[model samples]
Target: MAPKRMPKVYLVRHGETEWTINGRHTGTTDLPLTANGEAIMLKLGDKAAGPGKLIDPTLIGTVMVSPRLRAKRTFELIFSHSPVKPPMTIDERVREWTYGDYEGFYKHEAVAARKAKGLPSGEGGWDIWVDGCEGGESAQEMTDRADEVVRTVRDAHRKWYEDPERKEGDKGGDVLIVSHGHFSRCFLARWLALPLPAGQLFVLDPGGVCVGQYYHDLGKTALGAMNLGLI
Candidate 1:
């Protein structure tokens, strides 16, 4: 039997949609991936999620996904390549940040609207990390949601490690989260106790993966790899 090892959490961003291709802010809109997007996801599965691939399905303990269609479908495509399906759940917290009034607007359009309203809007103006969406999630709200993700992952790891009966090759330590781009970046920021604005530094591509793990117990979380592209 293979020796037991620390579980690595896999963070996945869903593939492209029309809105994404058009640079629109997508939130609360359950849009399907483009045909090309779906094809690429199937490729991602074959490249990354198998017995000895980068993300071995058998090693994953839990799989959490956004309730949105895009994210859910991404989860399906990736795991479809592997038979060892882990326990999966739908979590609204992993959903994208609500754009509210800015929904469906491109970057330039949103900036223009903010400028017209006399709100900060321009280069380095009206940044989501600072001003947030006028009618949707605030930076603090994103922080709260990210914190919840961190807490959930940490608690799961804690339980897995504390179980006296846990043996080598058991699949209860690694985790997988299929979510949106911005929110997944925010989760990475919060996982390292960084400021929400720092999330901007970690831009995730669509149909990509980020991996993280704990070093000296659940208290110390570490980012192992990120932006491992699939498509």
Candidate 2:
């Protein structure tokens, strides 16, 4: 068997929604993309997933999408123009972080509500990475789910790497994941074997695309690119 080659994973956040534009904690809320969001995603798809683009559609082997309408729609728009359409599977693990009581509340409002209820806030305020939303999933729980996703994808990649039919320099082993903002960040953190709180430092804007890949060794993963937008 040939030595395992590092594989790249593309993390894509869904297009803009009303709550996303308004900076609200949009968790478990199924919101559709706005007109502008759809337009932006169309352009992004052409630039990022088109031939000779950052994400070559032909090279994509696996596509995992969140079950949310916004995420599903974004994935559809992104590959609508591509010549190759990879099979897509809905993974509940890729869904957005559940905000529970903080749902529909803006950032400031969530912080204030937590304070009013005598809940402890991090030094930087009520960050979901630390405080996690009340009545929702804790950081540990989210980490567990995200880790499961990582394992699933990695297991598939390992099979591809071990396949004798695969040739060198073929990046077709890449995996594409379409999901929400916060959860995407968490997914990236877990991909690098970092703590969930470390996700707080990463930011994935609407319609943004980030790439993660193994470094010198297949066991070590690193961020290849992030916050890429359509030029």
Candidate 3:
């Protein structure tokens, strides 16, 4: 059999939470989705299915998500009407970065605190990707976690895609990863085997979906799209 083609991974940042709307670092806070967040999630399902870009609503594969209520609810709202229920799992590896000291603080306030101490902007002040929080993991640590999650997902999909006995339509794998904004960006970078600092290059908004594709023939990976289906 030919080498299996890995399926494209679709990552959706959970809908707007109170912290998200306020530009705060949420990271494992388990906040509920805002009213508008709910509305946008419903729209996302329709858009992904309506266009030929993603798997049809009836198609089945996997919908792994963070165990947090916000992430789980987003998955439920999006796939509520699908005829075929895909396998769902909660992978802690996909959870948001642990914000530690910065948790619950507004973005501006967080930046101000870093600046007060003469720290840099964008990513606290742990030195680029380093976690500036007093007690939380650094950016490099988050990158390590994200890398593990991507590796696990990639290995699983590779196995599924290589199952020769599977039918043609069943050959493809679709992963709906529901996670928080900052960590999602890190995951995207890891998916493309990019440097941890590269995560800052992408912005992941609530209810945004980023697609990454691995081109086997070309021996490379590409960010198919970013911040798609935003409302």
Candidate 4:
């Protein structure tokens, strides 16, 4: 069998929304990006997805986007000027963590509400990775969803690398994922084969981008870059 080729994956968290600015647990909410958010994303797209940039447009094999409008719009802005626009796939696995009853509530508000109801808030407070949202997905569930995306993208990468009809100098194998914050983190954790809770340690700001790739020639998965912002 031939050796597997190392393929890079880029995770882009959608730009700012009204709920994001208000610190609300935005899950399954379809809100458009603010004007400022759109502007920043455009700039980031130019910087990261432009020619001779970190995410070379010509090298992108697949683009996976969350079904939410916010995520979809972010993808639009980021690739608006790309010379080579890869086909996009709307994957539910990349959707934001479903907040359930906690949806639209700020973290502190959710904590206080849970306290009022005498619900256990864990050691410190309402840590989603620990407590998850009431009536929502557990950490394991999130991990499962993220794993689905990872598997799909990895398969795509393998197919791209092993394509016998691939043209010379094509270099097309990278996968790009445009999704939500918590979901993106979960995707990264799943990509690295780490525990779901480990995703809590990392923060992906609105409009931020992270890179995951195999190091040492596909011997080990590695995080090449994270929390990269245009502004």
Candidate 4 colliding pairs: none
What TM-scores do the predictions have? 0.93, 0.92, 0.84, 0.91
Candidate 4 on 116-179: residue-level lDDT in tens? 9899987676888878788888877888888888888878777876778754565778898999
lDDT preference between candidates 3 and 4, better one: 4
Q: Candidate 1, residues 1-231: lDDT per residue as tens digits?
A: 444566678999999899988889999999999998898889898888877778787777777899999999998887787866665689988999999989988877888888889997757556988888989999999999999988998787777767778665675577899999889989999998899999998978889899988776667889988878553
Number of colliding residue pairs in model 1? 0
Native-to-model Cα distance after best TM-score fit, residue 216 in candidate 4, in Å:
1.4
Model 4, CA-based lDDT: 0.84
User: For model 4, what is the alpha-carbon lDDT of residue 17?
Assistant: 94
lDDT digits (tens) for residues 92-192 of candidate 2: 88999998999989888988898899889777568788777789988888999899989988887777776778565565788889998889988989998
* Per-candidate local distance difference test: 0.85, 0.85, 0.73, 0.84
Per-residue lDDT of 75-178 in model 3, one digit per residue for the tens?
88776655544556898888887778778877666667778877666544345365446467787688789888887767766666666686565544656688
Against the true structure, candidate 4 reaches a TM-score of: 0.91
Ranking by lDDT: 2, 1, 4, 3
lDDT of 1 at 165: 82
Model 4 ranges off by over 4 Å: 1-5, 164-166, 229-231
Q: Give the residue spans of candidate 1 off by over 4 A.
A: 1-4, 229-231
Which stretches of model 3 miss by more than 4 angstroms?
1-6, 49-60, 111-128
C-alpha RMSD by candidate, in order = 2.0, 2.1, 3.2, 2.4
